[model samples]
Target: MGCSNNWCELYGSHTSLCGCFVAIVLHGNKYITNHKGQTKPTVLLDCLAQWGIEKIFCIIVDNATANTCALRKFQSSFSLLSNEAFVMDGEFMHIRCAAHITNLIVNDGLAEVDENVSTIRNAVGYVRSSTPRLRSFELWIDSGKLTRGNFPLDVKTRWNSTYLMLSKALEFRLAFDKMEAEDMLYNDYFMEFEGGAQDGGRGHDCYNPEESDGVE
Candidate 1:
């Protein structure tokens, strides 16, 4: 459950410890069931019914195997909420969440590439290990480094800081160039990172999804 202001402290803490838990009963938190590949429709149905949500306007979901299974289960449960509605409103429709489908496609495509790119990535790591070694390369950068319209030896890496670093550097390029000339800007990890917090680019899973829910 996501919390308010003191969110950092509440994160990773037990649910009971949360001061307040927002319950988006329709399609918010996902409860992976104990039974494998067996998401029950009644889980959400019972919760929504208990919350007194009658007249059943709509339900939203993402594209996941478990989610779709739960949706089908929910559809059947909604139909059976009353025998009269079961026979009358037989064509009850479920609206799939578009944000979910895109996530699945992106996940599948990236997984395929990650397996192939592992070795090349490892080789790059072996080359950039020591701070002093990386510093020594700056001399060569003056002769062969690719530069922008301004000057050479312009290696801009995030190392997981926000893009603000690059933005700030662009803003004060003159000062930074002077610092580089004075033998500053010398962190090996800053030049290359494992795409972690210290490295700021989007390695994966930064986009919104498209599919609503998946089929059982």
Candidate 2:
């Protein structure tokens, strides 16, 4: 009843601070296959039946079309089981995940500044690629009296990681500029990007330490 892909379902309880109900435990966590909308309701239904739960207040999910489909299927199937399966006739049962929505918003905004982010990502990658290069970068940081911190490489899919990498990289911008001038490897490293640093080459702005700093 499962496929190659792994899917997880989590259920938690929330109560008001003044409520006497305490020690709420998670009752739903299941491994399934193909978590698309069509398959999601079936699995979730099975879980509800197993746990003997008949009423649902809400189902929080990301803004994926599959989730929307899943919710529709769940509502219809659950209603067949019991007329009172959902609070308020399931009108407010589908709650879009706020964190996921914020992530989407941030990623959309980041798309407008892809080049600048890429430039900084590449610079951070270059510096942290090797121990010698990192030591040289540290030397530059020390010379410039900048705070030394761990360089973070960002995952393209995660905006929070990108934000952290950019924030940390900003602390050593002068060191990056110094490395661009004093370090031959750093200079040549950028030179290899999308042809040399000539007119219309990607290396033109990507090679500059201040390129990512322009992002606001």
Candidate 3:
């Protein structure tokens, strides 16, 4: 019986606490156990022992040092019990979270285009930061016959948010260009930004202007 445990946060009316949960799947049946603790190896071991789980095939967890240590300690303890349930000497016990790995890879890739992203983010922020600017942007959208929508600010910690911001920005590209031409404030800000970039020896547009124009 291979079982896995992971820590989760729980919120209550009065307080929040961290706890561990254990789950086992075999023959289409799943068993679960929950315990309160900091997800240390000893707490995990105690939880499993309380559940009378002597045979553990493996545990799947994120790539955390505490989880690795816990798995090692659990494997050692199981070995001492001479339990045959331990597979591959617990070599394949620790499974890293695939989603976490993907997020890391995506974030790393996004960093390559961070300058362009920051530019768009700043532009969106400027538009949405004030009621007057948002109303002006809406008027620009109407005049340009562009799609009516709001500019979304991206969350710095979320890659998907950046994606949404870029997607929406592309959809409203004409309106943004119209604002640059007609709105002195918007025009001055971009001009100053470009000047700063040039002075810093990074004289590049936030994104390729031609490419932005070509997007249908």
Q: Residue 140, candidate 1: how far off, in angstroms?
A: 12
| lDDT by residue (tens digit), candidate 2, 1-216 | 132221234345421111111112223355445656667777667766775667777777767787888889978988998777776787777877677798899899889978767777878887778777777777866544222255788888788888888877776777777777788877776667354443222222343454555332
Clashing residue pairs in candidate 2 are none
Residue 190 CA displacement from its true place in model 3, Å = 4.7
- The local distance difference test score of model 3 is 0.58
The lDDT for every candidate, in the order shown, is 0.37, 0.65, 0.58
Which ranking of candidates, highest TM-score first? 2, 3, 1
Name the best candidate (by lDDT).
2
Clashing pairs in 3: 2-57
Q: Among all windows of ten consecutive residues in candidate 1, which has the lowest summed lDDT?
A: 13-22
Choose 1 or 3, whichever is better by lDDT.
3
Cα lDDT of model 1 by residue, 99-176, tens digit: 446555544554554432232222223224444534454344443432232221212221212222223233333433
> Taking the tens digit of each residue's C-alpha lDDT, what string does model 3 give over 84-178?
65655556666666655666777788787777777777777768778778878888665442222446787776677777777777666677778
Better candidate number, 1 or 2, judged by lDDT:
2
Each candidate's TM vs. the true structure? Answer: 0.37, 0.74, 0.59
**lDDT of candidate model 2 versus the reference:** 0.65
